[model samples]
Target: MSDWEEDWDNGDSKATSKPYNKRNNAKDNSISNRSDESGRHRSSENRAPIRYPQAGEKRSNGQRHKHSEKIEVPSDLVGMLIGRGGANIQRIQNDYNVRVDLDKESGTATINGNTEQNVKDAYNDIEHHLNNGPGSRYNSKDGSSGHQSNAIYNFQLKGRNNKPGDTDDIEMDPSGVIDWEALNKKAKKERAARWSKLPELRKDFYNEDPEVANLTPREVARLREENNNITVSRVFQQENVSENIPNPVWKFEQCFSAYPDLLEEIYKQDFRKPSPIQSQAWPILLKGEDMIGIAQTGTGKTLAFLLPAMIHTEYQLTPRSQRKGPNVLVLAPTRELALQIEKEVNKYSFRGMKAVCVYGGGNRREQISVVKGGVEIIICTPGRLNDLIEAEVIDVTSITYLILDEADRMLDMGFEPQIRKVLLDIRPDRQTVMTSATWPPGVRRLAQSYMSNPIQVCVGSLDLAATHTVKQVIEIMDDGDKFYKIREFVRNMGKDDKAIVFCGKKTRADDLSSDLTLEGYMCACIHGSREQSDREQAIADITSGHIKLLIATDVASRGLDIEDITHVINFDFPRNIEEYVHRVGRTGRAGRSGTSISFITREDWGVAKELISILEEADQEVPIDLRNMAERFKSMKDRRANESSKFNDRDGNSGSRGYRGGGGAGGRGRRDRY
Candidate 1:
């Protein structure tokens, strides 16, 4: 016999000498005698009779009987609960002063004791053993507790919380004492109650004007069909909105009549209807609510926010002499974007509202004079705006409407401090609107810090990838082969086809432009280092068909709308996927088909997986070589993560002696082999 078996037998003998054990022995003898007298019929009387020992009965025999509790154990856990030859069961019975009887066929264990508390304690012990396995001890305070049962269940269900080759799931608590199902039901009820109180959409009400009436059912159906067919998607007043806010209008004529002159201007521009961004952003801004507009490039985001600002200013117009400063301030990231916005401003700046553009490399005195001459709208870059504000040439205290265009680009170009300074100097109750092509973390932080209860409006999926309107051609080649490939592509193109080649550095652009021009190709270059006049001339030449080929940096990637550009070439990959999206967006404007080609090399391995994912999502054909490179990169990344975790587990510090002696050398060896 094993040591545990011998000890258990001796324990039973020692226990029989005690008075309580003696009383239990006598009761067992009486039951056995009754069973013998009943013979084979005893099997039919399996149910035990309920008996409650009174105080008087306890005095007679120095013992008492209480109610018995039955607990069903899982069939697989029967052996672990009973132990070898039933030693563990007997140990629990002796320690807790209870009777534990197991029905092997049904897997039911009935525990009886002198009191209810004793029965509960015995059941708790049995549960702990079953959960922790056969090696676990009874009456041990270190076992699983009630609070950790839910976490344990979740761990088991998920099969190793995070990574493979990990046994962390088995280490969680296994007490099984908590009622998880009841808790989950209660949480679901609370969620349902919260959703029941959400605001309902009032589709009939058009605007706050009392003259507009609710639309009929037939009209509503027609409007919905138009919206769906045109792909105009919108989410209105998402969070913390008042109950009285109305749904957005579908047609430009439905809402544009409030400003008849603006409607006339729209018709004069040959605009048939509002774009998706305009259709959604108009009503929210009209209601005087702060908003963040997210849409793809070349989708008319400029006019989306501009028209509403003009309408609001026209509604609260005062005499020119009485106006303190510009009523609306539009901030752009680049001088080119600022100029474009100013041009659009002129189209809708009717009704005696003057608009001016301010940027660097322009005459500072002239900009100062324009601001002093009392314009209703001022469009400028962040740097020039900050300079004018510090110079005290412009007063922003009276500004009521603030707009930040290309907001993500501004944050990317290290303009946050200047943007924040201008925001701080403006009026406290200004209705701020921010528009971006993508919503990175920095843009979200800026919105939370400055705006008040802003509504987010996304016109389409928020993907920082090139649109399907542009055909993407990906080529995997070495750095030395890029020039040869570009030469071949340019020779194959028609003489009148316009193309813009993008490079990573200013010096590279200048060098490439000089080489191409010397080789008898009409090419020009533009970057931040070039004079503003030179850059302006380059853009003008490209637009007027004087220069068919242009090499530039990321400055021209955004907000420069050239109409008939047929193709875009990325001679060098961009810093990220977002920049790549903008660089290719220069083409595919105004519903015209275009093409973009990229030269990806081995140095671009870090972003290979992301590039493949973007192309896949856009339904573009991916090259086989790039797919293999992405797979290799993923495997390398996962291996490094596993090695780092192992090192951290061995020693708290990665550079510790133990880790260096073990995982560090192994990692170096693996890298060498690779």
Candidate 2:
């Protein structure tokens, strides 16, 4: 199970049950002042991929908010299909890899999956079974599924007391602007493309010289090794990269000679040359090509897209006043990221073009007022932006440059609904660029669905590879010894050295901060449970050197860009391998060398194999015991799978699917699966 241990909100990341404030309700008095996090005021929601609450809801403990689709069955056939002792339901859960909350009294079974596709598949299968069950009235004589009525009732639960599909405080748009019909229509169109779906991972694309059509993860990693961050053609192309793709610009003048204003901004920052990603990304983005930028954090991804967005906005034939919405739209996964992008946009004045970051937690009216007044660029989190769109305060019809920054992270936080909702209204022909550290299936699926023929630009390896600049150290120890291990490591740091301690849980971070503080360490902590303002202060302390240590969860892993961070201590190995890469990335940033210390334990055996692989990829030394643990875990898993296969064979059931309830449950799972 993931951090939430609950199914994702059908992969939409909407508030399944717990809603924040009503749309356009009076300003939330509790929230005051302008916040940089264009995301909602997350109450420590942690890394729950199921539900991302809006402004008013509380998720301090980072619990899962159950959003479900309930199907009403005839009371007579319910028991028959359910099977005795709920055996049939358990089989469905294991077979389809979904969750079913049986409401025997109501004769309704609630179905949910970690992703949208999974939920839809499970729902369809259940409906089929119900129709074919013993004495099912819907069953046809030809062994075909009979005409099924509307048995599924979908609802977004509200409040703590409400159950799945609860119908309280549900709001509807009378103007037909935010209706489901139009959104579904738009979604149906996005799926028409051949590459819109995630490719099955069974094929091997890792030969010495792989075929051009096979763009597998291993092949991408191999290309990263061969290219060594240099721009190359065809070897890494996804077949869609056209013959005349623009060449990378090494010198600043070579790319920006047309825009002296932009050149001046580059000089102001004292930037000498284009970074690896920026070198290649500029020409493609400036050419209005849809792109997927696979680069690490702090590699200047913002300017790669932002500069082009400005150029695109200025060249637009439509007048600013006549345009319904801003010509450029930037969707960030978190409030911090949205705010960061807006700040970058501010650094360089682009024809006096205005930009606003709208996220959760901030005063909505202030953001809306900024957009309504007039703006050429809009930087916002998905929820807040969606709210503004539904309220009709902002229009996306005129948007020509759309950016999904940290696109993979947005999906991990379950912001797909907000992203998809906003994209539905935008023109399909817009130039879209999605930047991500990892190219997971979810992000790829999103690109295929929304983007035109996209050119993939990967600076580093795509196989969950670690930053080569960072020195990775792995320690095998008991949980009791971890505190002392980190303490000793911190004690040896230089005066100017700064470090971030990452813990898995919010309470663990708070507890560790307390422990470290009592031991006379200058430290602060931030996690999903922390308030937006507190998170700001924690980041501020580390950046200003006011505190030597900043304890954090994955919240600070991606967006926080403090250049002087000297070390990263994985007080707890991250929940997954991709997160581990992101956590370590916080330290080794912007060409700066850094060190990362990770402590492993027996219980974390499942992660051992990938950990070793990441270590090897970075040329970091791996302990012998860690490799042993990985082998043992792999053997144990295979053994269990073999036993289960035999059992399934005896029972005459299909159970060959791998990794149940893990990554296999959702197509969006990290491709770093061992």
lDDT tens per residue, model 1, 314-363: 66545446666778899988777887888888887478889889877667
Q: Which portions of model 2 miss their true places by more than 4 Å?
A: 1-227, 230-242, 642-674
Candidate 1 has its poorest 10 consecutive residues by lDDT at 28-37
Candidate 1 structure, TM-score to reference? 0.63
Candidate 2 lDDT by residue in tens digits, 129-225: 6755555664434443322211221223322222323323233243212234544564466555522332211111111212333456565445445
Cα TM-score per model: 0.63, 0.67
* RMSD in Å for all candidates: 26.5, 14.4
Q: Give the range where candidate 2 is weakest over 10 consecutive residues by summed lDDT.
A: 200-209
How many backbone clashes does every candidate have?
Answer: 0, 11
